[model samples]
Target: MRVLVTGAQGQVGYELLQRVPDGFAVFGYGSQDLDISNADQVRAVFKAVKPELVINAAAYTAVDKAESDAERAYAVNSDGVGLLAAAAENLGIPLLHISTDYVFSGDGDKPYTPEDVTHPTGVYGLSKLAGEKQLSEQCSRHLVLRTSWVFGAHGNNFVKTMLRLGSDRDTLSIVADQHGGPTSAGSIAETLWALASVFRRDGRLGWGVYHYSGAPACSWYDFAKEIFTQAADLGLLEKSPNVNAITTAEYPTPAKRPMWSVLDCEKLVDAHGLVPKNWVQELQTVLRQLGERQSV
Candidate 1:
């Protein structure tokens, strides 16, 4: 399979490139190499690559920045996805798209199912929801995998941020009111590949919106505490910082974060025999990788 992945420099994008299985040819492009928001660029890349499968990792992921930069957010998150769908549809191929948990209003208590009513409270979430709609409307064969709280060794994420803060500050304050699973980028990339392999064998997938996040949801405070513990154990941190639990009001941002971002991944498991990985274990792997990178 000739798979073309956008946002190649991103957390998940880098993993997608690195973990290409045998019998598959993967081509990855960063924002500079292939600007997904540009129609001409997207069309030209698709034409040149002649990809049999298209996995769109490109997105405007700056949540707080998207509040003030709605146009750019929609351009990449909404318009860019639509363009990819059009290109992939024209080629008669499957378009695998990544979406976020922010599509919800953050008021719900239980895990969000794929069929839950979407009510995004911020511009970023609104833009991503629009992208999901665009993909469904523009392409016939597509899978919109919605994930939450993505962190990884390859790019900027909560894990790296916490590690940086933990090393510099004696005490770190994290929002405890907000809760969600801290998904690993490598795990997400592998999940996409597993679907790609299935599609290669069967020539089709269950094909729809599905949720795949880390298991056992936790708050930002909880996530930070774990990061410090694992990082210190791995000798990545000199000493664990004192993590303080704080409310959302204590740390304000431009965008409204989901109070509850836990996603129900049963649909994916039932359809594809895929389940979410334990994030605590995944965190250990990430810390080890970060340690290796630091050594180099």
Candidate 2:
């Protein structure tokens, strides 16, 4: 079957392009190639491709920057998703859209489930929630897969940032109070392909909102320290820098993040019998890919 993907240059989208699996035609469009916020362009692309399935990876993901650019964020995150959902619905195709864990208030004592009430603390989260609503209302068949803390070899994500900073600075401070999984984009892509395969085979698989992220949660400080450790062990760094743990208050940002962004993956396990990848183990692959790219 043919599939169309947007935001092909992003962390998750890049992974989707890299790992399309066999027997599936995957077509992708970057921001310059397709402006998702533009409804006419979205419809035109759908008309041209006429894909059997659509995976919308396009998003305005500048969480902190969304505070200053709510209009842009909503346009892409909210309106663009509606357009995609509607197009997929009209074409009688299935749509799988990526969402964020920031949809919750982040004060949950336990990990978040798909049915939990949403109360986004920042503009980015709020806009993403709006898109979720749009997709549910507009599409007949849709899969809203919500995830968190995505990192990859080819994106300006937390891991890449930490690697750059840790290599240059003697010491760096990361928020300890904040806890979540550092998910590898590669794992998410593979999961999507697996889900798609199941859907193709069954054509009546589970569909709706689901939560998936890296197994085991850790604070930002923990994730940073791990990055340094693995990088040094891989010879990417001569020595690991000092990672100082600090509270969120010590380092303020334009957007307020959910203190605990951990999401439960049991629902996905029940539906697809798939568990999330252990990020610690996957980090090695990411670092190796990045290191190889750098050497090239």
Highest lDDT scorer: 1
**Residue 273 Cα positional deviation in candidate 2, in Å, after optimal superposition:** 0.9
lDDT of 1 by residue, 103-198 (tens): 999899999999999999999999999999999999999999999999999889988888888889999888999989889999999999999999
Clashing residue pairs found in predicted model 2: none
Summarize candidate 2's per-residue lDDT along 109-137 as a digit string, tens digits.
78999999899999999999999999999
The clash count of every prediction, one per candidate, is 0, 0
Model 1 stretches astray by more than 4 angstroms: none
* Alpha-carbon shift of residue 118 in model 1 (angstroms): 0.5
Name the runs in model 2 displaced over 4 angstroms: none
Candidate 1 residue 220 Cα shift, in angstroms, is: 0.6
